[model samples]
Target: MAPPAPARRPYHHGDLRRAILTAALDVVAADGPGAISLRDLARRAGVSHAAPAHHFKDRAGLLTAIAAEGYSLLADALAEVPAGTPDSLRELGVQYVRFALAHPAHFEVMHRPELLHRDDLEFVAARSLAWHRLRRGVESRAAAGRGPDLEQAVLAAWSLAHGYATLRLSGNIPGEGDPAEAFRALARLTFGEPGD
Candidate 1:
Protein backbone atom coordinates (compact mmCIF):
# COMPACT_ATOMS: atom_id res chain seq x y z
CA MET A 1 0.00 0.00 0.00
CA ALA A 2 1.01 3.61 -0.49
CA PRO A 3 2.25 5.67 2.43
CA PRO A 4 -0.45 7.20 4.62
CA ALA A 5 -1.53 10.69 3.69
CA PRO A 6 -0.22 13.51 5.81
CA ALA A 7 -2.58 15.33 8.14
CA ARG A 8 -3.67 18.88 7.23
CA ARG A 9 -2.21 21.77 9.12
CA PRO A 10 -4.34 23.06 11.99
CA TYR A 11 -6.28 26.10 10.91
CA HIS A 12 -5.15 29.33 12.53
CA HIS A 13 -7.07 32.42 11.65
CA GLY A 14 -9.28 35.25 12.86
CA ASP A 15 -12.60 33.54 12.01
CA LEU A 16 -12.17 29.95 13.03
CA ARG A 17 -15.54 29.95 14.76
CA ARG A 18 -17.38 30.89 11.55
CA ALA A 19 -15.32 28.41 9.54
CA ILE A 20 -16.09 25.60 11.96
CA LEU A 21 -19.76 26.46 11.99
CA THR A 22 -19.90 26.52 8.20
CA ALA A 23 -18.14 23.14 8.09
CA ALA A 24 -20.60 21.75 10.61
CA LEU A 25 -23.53 22.92 8.51
CA ASP A 26 -22.04 21.31 5.44
CA VAL A 27 -21.55 18.05 7.31
CA VAL A 28 -25.09 18.14 8.59
CA ALA A 29 -26.46 18.87 5.14
CA ALA A 30 -24.49 16.00 3.65
CA ASP A 31 -24.87 13.37 6.43
CA GLY A 32 -27.54 14.57 8.87
CA PRO A 33 -27.04 15.97 12.32
CA GLY A 34 -26.31 12.58 13.87
CA ALA A 35 -23.04 12.45 12.01
CA ILE A 36 -21.65 15.68 13.42
CA SER A 37 -18.69 15.64 15.78
CA LEU A 38 -16.32 18.37 16.89
CA ARG A 39 -13.38 16.36 15.67
CA ASP A 40 -15.07 15.81 12.34
CA LEU A 41 -15.85 19.49 12.02
CA ALA A 42 -12.27 20.35 12.84
CA ARG A 43 -11.09 17.91 10.23
CA ARG A 44 -13.37 19.43 7.63
CA ALA A 45 -12.09 22.87 8.52
CA GLY A 46 -8.49 21.65 8.24
CA VAL A 47 -7.88 22.46 11.89
CA SER A 48 -6.53 20.50 14.79
CA HIS A 49 -9.11 18.20 16.34
CA ALA A 50 -8.97 20.20 19.54
CA ALA A 51 -9.63 23.52 17.78
CA PRO A 52 -13.39 23.07 17.78
CA ALA A 53 -13.41 22.81 21.54
CA HIS A 54 -12.24 26.38 21.84
CA HIS A 55 -15.40 27.65 20.15
CA PHE A 56 -18.09 25.00 20.71
CA LYS A 57 -16.93 23.05 23.76
CA ASP A 58 -18.96 19.98 22.71
CA ARG A 59 -21.48 18.61 20.25
CA ALA A 60 -24.42 20.17 22.04
CA GLY A 61 -22.72 23.54 22.03
CA LEU A 62 -22.08 23.38 18.30
CA LEU A 63 -25.64 22.32 17.60
CA THR A 64 -26.88 25.10 19.82
CA ALA A 65 -25.02 27.66 17.75
CA ILE A 66 -26.55 26.27 14.59
CA ALA A 67 -30.01 26.35 16.14
CA ALA A 68 -29.46 29.89 17.36
CA GLU A 69 -28.38 31.04 13.93
CA GLY A 70 -31.43 29.38 12.41
CA TYR A 71 -33.74 31.17 14.77
CA SER A 72 -32.11 34.49 14.05
CA LEU A 73 -32.50 33.95 10.32
CA LEU A 74 -36.12 32.86 10.77
CA ALA A 75 -36.86 35.95 12.77
CA ASP A 76 -35.47 38.10 9.98
CA ALA A 77 -37.61 36.34 7.40
CA LEU A 78 -40.80 36.72 9.45
CA ALA A 79 -40.08 40.37 10.09
CA GLU A 80 -40.99 41.07 6.51
CA VAL A 81 -44.62 40.21 7.16
CA PRO A 82 -46.48 43.48 7.51
CA ALA A 83 -48.01 43.76 10.95
CA GLY A 84 -51.77 44.18 11.65
CA THR A 85 -52.90 42.64 8.39
CA PRO A 86 -55.04 39.54 8.07
CA ASP A 87 -52.96 38.23 5.16
CA SER A 88 -49.78 38.73 7.16
CA LEU A 89 -50.41 35.37 8.83
CA ARG A 90 -50.30 33.53 5.54
CA GLU A 91 -47.31 35.54 4.43
CA LEU A 92 -45.52 34.66 7.63
CA GLY A 93 -46.35 30.98 7.15
CA VAL A 94 -45.01 31.08 3.61
CA GLN A 95 -41.84 32.76 4.78
CA TYR A 96 -41.46 30.09 7.46
CA VAL A 97 -41.69 27.29 4.94
CA ARG A 98 -39.35 29.11 2.56
CA PHE A 99 -36.77 29.60 5.28
CA ALA A 100 -36.90 25.89 6.05
CA LEU A 101 -36.42 25.01 2.42
CA ALA A 102 -33.54 27.40 1.99
CA HIS A 103 -31.73 26.23 5.10
CA PRO A 104 -32.56 22.59 5.54
CA ALA A 105 -29.63 21.87 7.83
CA HIS A 106 -30.40 24.81 10.08
CA PHE A 107 -34.09 23.94 10.06
CA GLU A 108 -33.31 20.36 11.06
CA VAL A 109 -31.18 21.28 14.08
CA MET A 110 -33.48 24.15 15.09
CA HIS A 111 -36.56 22.10 15.89
CA ARG A 112 -34.62 19.33 17.64
CA PRO A 113 -34.17 21.00 20.99
CA GLU A 114 -32.81 17.84 22.57
CA LEU A 115 -29.88 18.02 20.19
CA LEU A 116 -28.88 21.49 21.36
CA HIS A 117 -28.04 23.40 24.50
CA ARG A 118 -31.46 24.99 24.75
CA ASP A 119 -30.54 27.09 27.75
CA ASP A 120 -27.63 28.90 26.17
CA LEU A 121 -28.28 32.64 26.48
CA GLU A 122 -27.94 33.41 22.79
CA PHE A 123 -29.95 30.35 21.81
CA VAL A 124 -32.73 31.21 24.24
CA ALA A 125 -32.85 34.80 23.10
CA ALA A 126 -32.92 33.90 19.42
CA ARG A 127 -35.62 31.26 19.98
CA SER A 128 -37.68 33.70 21.99
CA LEU A 129 -37.42 36.31 19.26
CA ALA A 130 -38.54 33.88 16.57
CA TRP A 131 -41.41 32.61 18.74
CA HIS A 132 -42.52 36.11 19.57
CA ARG A 133 -42.44 37.10 15.93
CA LEU A 134 -44.70 34.19 15.00
CA ARG A 135 -47.04 34.93 17.87
CA ARG A 136 -47.20 38.57 16.92
CA GLY A 137 -48.16 37.74 13.38
CA VAL A 138 -51.03 35.59 14.60
CA GLU A 139 -52.03 38.12 17.19
CA SER A 140 -52.21 40.81 14.51
CA ARG A 141 -54.96 38.90 12.77
CA ALA A 142 -56.84 38.31 15.97
CA ALA A 143 -56.60 41.95 16.85
CA ALA A 144 -58.03 42.85 13.46
CA GLY A 145 -61.02 40.52 14.05
CA ARG A 146 -59.87 38.07 11.43
CA GLY A 147 -59.41 35.13 13.83
CA PRO A 148 -61.57 34.19 16.79
CA ASP A 149 -59.01 32.53 19.06
CA LEU A 150 -55.44 33.78 19.20
CA GLU A 151 -53.98 30.62 20.68
CA GLN A 152 -55.88 28.29 18.36
CA ALA A 153 -55.03 30.35 15.31
CA VAL A 154 -51.38 30.46 16.26
CA LEU A 155 -51.30 26.69 16.73
CA ALA A 156 -53.12 26.07 13.47
CA ALA A 157 -50.92 28.36 11.41
CA TRP A 158 -47.73 27.01 12.94
CA SER A 159 -48.82 23.41 12.45
CA LEU A 160 -49.82 24.03 8.88
CA ALA A 161 -46.57 25.78 7.89
CA HIS A 162 -44.31 23.43 9.85
CA GLY A 163 -46.08 20.36 8.53
CA TYR A 164 -45.75 21.60 4.98
CA ALA A 165 -42.08 22.38 5.43
CA THR A 166 -41.42 19.00 7.03
CA LEU A 167 -43.28 17.17 4.32
CA ARG A 168 -41.61 19.11 1.54
CA LEU A 169 -38.16 18.52 2.98
CA SER A 170 -38.88 14.80 3.37
CA GLY A 171 -40.03 14.56 -0.29
CA ASN A 172 -43.56 13.70 0.74
CA ILE A 173 -45.10 16.54 -1.20
CA PRO A 174 -46.17 15.65 -4.77
CA GLY A 175 -46.66 17.97 -7.72
CA GLU A 176 -44.94 19.50 -10.74
CA GLY A 177 -45.57 23.10 -9.81
CA ASP A 178 -43.23 25.34 -7.85
CA PRO A 179 -43.03 24.26 -4.23
CA ALA A 180 -43.64 27.82 -3.10
CA GLU A 181 -46.85 28.05 -5.09
CA ALA A 182 -47.90 24.66 -3.79
CA PHE A 183 -47.33 25.94 -0.28
CA ARG A 184 -49.39 29.06 -0.97
CA ALA A 185 -52.23 27.00 -2.44
CA LEU A 186 -52.16 24.66 0.53
CA ALA A 187 -52.21 27.60 2.91
CA ARG A 188 -55.25 29.07 1.17
CA LEU A 189 -57.00 25.70 1.07
CA THR A 190 -56.32 24.85 4.71
CA PHE A 191 -56.78 28.31 6.18
CA GLY A 192 -59.60 29.42 3.91
CA GLU A 193 -57.95 32.48 2.30
CA PRO A 194 -55.81 35.05 4.12
CA GLY A 195 -58.56 37.23 5.56
CA ASP A 196 -61.27 34.61 5.89
Candidate 2:
Protein backbone atom coordinates (compact mmCIF):
# COMPACT_ATOMS: atom_id res chain seq x y z
CA MET A 1 0.00 0.00 0.00
CA ALA A 2 1.17 3.52 -0.77
CA PRO A 3 2.27 5.61 2.15
CA PRO A 4 -0.15 8.21 3.50
CA ALA A 5 0.22 11.69 2.00
CA PRO A 6 2.86 13.57 3.92
CA ALA A 7 1.83 16.38 6.20
CA ARG A 8 2.67 19.96 5.23
CA ARG A 9 5.93 20.87 6.90
CA PRO A 10 5.32 24.07 8.82
CA TYR A 11 7.30 26.79 7.15
CA HIS A 12 9.03 28.75 9.87
CA HIS A 13 10.10 31.73 7.79
CA GLY A 14 9.12 33.13 4.41
CA ASP A 15 6.40 31.11 2.79
CA LEU A 16 7.16 30.16 -0.83
CA ARG A 17 3.65 30.95 -2.06
CA ARG A 18 3.53 34.38 -0.45
CA ALA A 19 7.07 35.06 -1.61
CA ILE A 20 6.10 34.27 -5.17
CA LEU A 21 3.05 36.54 -4.89
CA THR A 22 5.20 39.31 -3.46
CA ALA A 23 7.63 39.00 -6.31
CA ALA A 24 4.78 38.84 -8.79
CA LEU A 25 3.38 42.07 -7.38
CA ASP A 26 6.77 43.74 -7.66
CA VAL A 27 6.93 42.71 -11.30
CA VAL A 28 3.43 44.02 -11.99
CA ALA A 29 4.14 47.36 -10.28
CA ALA A 30 7.43 47.86 -12.10
CA ASP A 31 6.43 46.73 -15.57
CA GLY A 32 2.66 46.28 -15.68
CA PRO A 33 0.78 43.10 -16.66
CA GLY A 34 2.12 42.77 -20.18
CA ALA A 35 5.70 42.62 -18.88
CA ILE A 36 5.18 40.02 -16.15
CA SER A 37 6.22 36.42 -16.79
CA LEU A 38 5.93 33.32 -14.60
CA ARG A 39 9.57 32.32 -14.93
CA ASP A 40 10.71 35.84 -14.17
CA LEU A 41 8.46 35.96 -11.14
CA ALA A 42 9.76 32.60 -9.95
CA ARG A 43 13.37 33.71 -10.34
CA ARG A 44 12.72 36.95 -8.51
CA ALA A 45 10.97 34.99 -5.79
CA GLY A 46 14.02 32.73 -5.42
CA VAL A 47 11.94 29.62 -6.00
CA SER A 48 11.85 26.87 -8.58
CA HIS A 49 10.07 27.78 -11.84
CA ALA A 50 7.43 25.25 -10.85
CA ALA A 51 6.79 26.93 -7.53
CA PRO A 52 4.57 29.68 -8.86
CA ALA A 53 2.62 27.22 -10.93
CA HIS A 54 1.95 25.22 -7.79
CA HIS A 55 0.25 28.24 -6.25
CA PHE A 56 -1.17 29.76 -9.41
CA LYS A 57 -1.99 27.44 -12.26
CA ASP A 58 -1.02 30.10 -14.80
CA ARG A 59 -0.80 33.81 -15.43
CA ALA A 60 -4.57 34.18 -15.47
CA GLY A 61 -4.83 32.45 -12.10
CA LEU A 62 -2.16 34.65 -10.61
CA LEU A 63 -3.84 37.78 -11.93
CA THR A 64 -7.21 36.61 -10.69
CA ALA A 65 -5.78 36.04 -7.24
CA ILE A 66 -4.32 39.51 -7.26
CA ALA A 67 -7.67 40.95 -8.28
CA ALA A 68 -9.47 39.04 -5.53
CA GLU A 69 -7.01 40.30 -2.96
CA GLY A 70 -7.31 43.83 -4.25
CA TYR A 71 -11.07 43.78 -4.02
CA SER A 72 -10.93 42.41 -0.48
CA LEU A 73 -8.44 45.10 0.50
CA LEU A 74 -10.45 47.89 -1.07
CA ALA A 75 -13.53 46.63 0.70
CA ASP A 76 -11.67 46.74 4.00
CA ALA A 77 -10.47 50.25 3.31
CA LEU A 78 -13.98 51.41 2.48
CA ALA A 79 -15.19 49.84 5.69
CA GLU A 80 -12.43 51.50 7.70
CA VAL A 81 -13.73 55.01 7.01
CA PRO A 82 -17.27 55.28 8.29
CA ALA A 83 -20.05 55.85 5.75
CA GLY A 84 -20.94 59.31 6.98
CA THR A 85 -22.64 62.09 5.06
CA PRO A 86 -21.20 64.91 2.92
CA ASP A 87 -17.44 64.44 3.32
CA SER A 88 -17.59 60.72 3.90
CA LEU A 89 -17.88 59.94 0.22
CA ARG A 90 -15.06 62.34 -0.45
CA GLU A 91 -12.99 60.72 2.26
CA LEU A 92 -13.66 57.28 0.79
CA GLY A 93 -12.61 58.56 -2.60
CA VAL A 94 -9.29 59.69 -1.21
CA GLN A 95 -8.93 56.39 0.57
CA TYR A 96 -9.49 54.57 -2.72
CA VAL A 97 -6.58 56.45 -4.24
CA ARG A 98 -4.53 55.76 -1.16
CA PHE A 99 -5.24 52.04 -1.46
CA ALA A 100 -3.98 51.98 -5.04
CA LEU A 101 -0.88 54.00 -4.19
CA ALA A 102 -0.19 51.76 -1.25
CA HIS A 103 -0.78 48.55 -3.16
CA PRO A 104 0.22 49.35 -6.70
CA ALA A 105 0.74 45.69 -7.54
CA HIS A 106 -2.76 44.82 -6.44
CA PHE A 107 -4.07 47.96 -8.10
CA GLU A 108 -2.62 46.83 -11.40
CA VAL A 109 -4.98 43.87 -11.52
CA MET A 110 -7.95 45.06 -9.46
CA HIS A 111 -9.89 46.77 -12.20
CA ARG A 112 -8.82 44.72 -15.18
CA PRO A 113 -12.02 42.89 -15.99
CA GLU A 114 -10.30 40.55 -18.39
CA LEU A 115 -7.76 39.45 -15.81
CA LEU A 116 -10.29 39.13 -13.00
CA HIS A 117 -12.75 36.36 -12.16
CA ARG A 118 -15.95 38.34 -12.37
CA ASP A 119 -18.09 35.23 -12.47
CA ASP A 120 -16.54 33.70 -9.39
CA LEU A 121 -18.72 34.02 -6.31
CA GLU A 122 -15.91 35.24 -4.05
CA PHE A 123 -14.75 37.85 -6.51
CA VAL A 124 -18.28 38.97 -7.21
CA ALA A 125 -19.00 39.23 -3.49
CA ALA A 126 -15.93 41.35 -2.80
CA ARG A 127 -16.49 43.67 -5.74
CA SER A 128 -20.19 44.04 -4.96
CA LEU A 129 -19.49 44.80 -1.31
CA ALA A 130 -17.06 47.60 -2.11
CA TRP A 131 -19.42 49.13 -4.64
CA HIS A 132 -22.35 48.79 -2.27
CA ARG A 133 -20.42 50.67 0.36
CA LEU A 134 -19.74 53.47 -2.07
CA ARG A 135 -23.38 53.57 -3.13
CA ARG A 136 -24.51 53.58 0.47
CA GLY A 137 -22.16 56.43 1.20
CA VAL A 138 -23.68 58.35 -1.67
CA GLU A 139 -27.13 57.66 -0.28
CA SER A 140 -25.99 58.95 3.07
CA ARG A 141 -24.66 62.13 1.49
CA ALA A 142 -27.95 62.68 -0.28
CA ALA A 143 -29.74 62.12 3.03
CA ALA A 144 -27.57 64.88 4.45
CA GLY A 145 -28.97 67.18 1.76
CA ARG A 146 -25.87 67.34 -0.38
CA GLY A 147 -26.96 66.26 -3.83
CA PRO A 148 -29.14 66.82 -6.89
CA ASP A 149 -29.97 63.46 -8.54
CA LEU A 150 -29.00 60.24 -6.76
CA GLU A 151 -27.80 58.46 -9.87
CA GLN A 152 -26.00 61.51 -11.14
CA ALA A 153 -24.41 62.17 -7.76
CA VAL A 154 -23.18 58.59 -7.38
CA LEU A 155 -21.95 58.41 -10.97
CA ALA A 156 -20.16 61.72 -10.60
CA ALA A 157 -18.49 60.60 -7.39
CA TRP A 158 -17.46 57.29 -8.95
CA SER A 159 -16.09 58.97 -12.04
CA LEU A 160 -14.07 61.53 -10.12
CA ALA A 161 -12.40 58.96 -7.91
CA HIS A 162 -11.93 56.33 -10.61
CA GLY A 163 -10.54 58.81 -13.11
CA TYR A 164 -8.24 60.38 -10.54
CA ALA A 165 -6.87 56.99 -9.54
CA THR A 166 -6.35 55.93 -13.15
CA LEU A 167 -4.58 59.16 -13.99
CA ARG A 168 -2.32 58.96 -10.95
CA LEU A 169 -1.41 55.33 -11.63
CA SER A 170 -0.75 55.91 -15.32
CA GLY A 171 1.56 58.90 -14.57
CA ASN A 172 -0.74 61.20 -16.53
CA ILE A 173 -0.72 63.57 -13.57
CA PRO A 174 2.66 65.00 -12.67
CA GLY A 175 3.79 65.42 -9.09
CA GLU A 176 3.37 68.91 -7.72
CA GLY A 177 0.55 69.10 -5.22
CA ASP A 178 -1.48 66.43 -3.42
CA PRO A 179 -3.45 64.06 -5.65
CA ALA A 180 -6.01 63.53 -2.90
CA GLU A 181 -6.57 67.25 -2.58
CA ALA A 182 -7.01 67.51 -6.32
CA PHE A 183 -9.45 64.63 -6.19
CA ARG A 184 -11.34 66.31 -3.36
CA ALA A 185 -11.71 69.43 -5.46
CA LEU A 186 -13.10 67.36 -8.31
CA ALA A 187 -15.45 65.61 -5.92
CA ARG A 188 -16.73 68.94 -4.69
CA LEU A 189 -17.34 70.09 -8.23
CA THR A 190 -19.05 66.82 -9.10
CA PHE A 191 -21.25 67.00 -6.04
CA GLY A 192 -21.91 70.68 -6.66
CA GLU A 193 -20.77 71.54 -3.20
CA PRO A 194 -21.10 75.25 -2.40
CA GLY A 195 -20.56 78.00 -5.01
CA ASP A 196 -18.61 76.39 -7.83
lDDT of 2 by residue, 84-128 (tens): 645688888888888877887888787788875567766778888
TM-score of 2: 0.82
Instruction: State, as a TM-score between 0 and 1, how close model 1 is to the true structure.
Output: 0.90
Shift of residue 123 alpha carbon in model 2, Å: 2.3
- Per residue, candidate 1 scores C-alpha lDDT tens digits across 29-106 of 999999998987788778789988999999999999999999999999999888777678788888999999999999
Q: Any residue pairs clashing in model 1, and if so which?
A: none
Task: State how far residue 134 of model 2 sits from its true place (Å).
Answer: 1.7
Which candidate should be chosen as best, given lDDT against the real structure?
1
User: Which residue pairs of candidate 2 clash?
Assistant: none
**What TM-score goes with each of the models?**
0.90, 0.82
lDDT of 1 at 75: 97
**Lowest-scoring 10 consecutive residues by lDDT in candidate 2?**
187-196
Question: lDDT for model 1, on a 0 to 1 scale?
Answer: 0.88
Each candidate structure's count of clashing pairs = 0, 0
Which 10 residues in a row give candidate 1 its minimum summed lDDT? 174-183
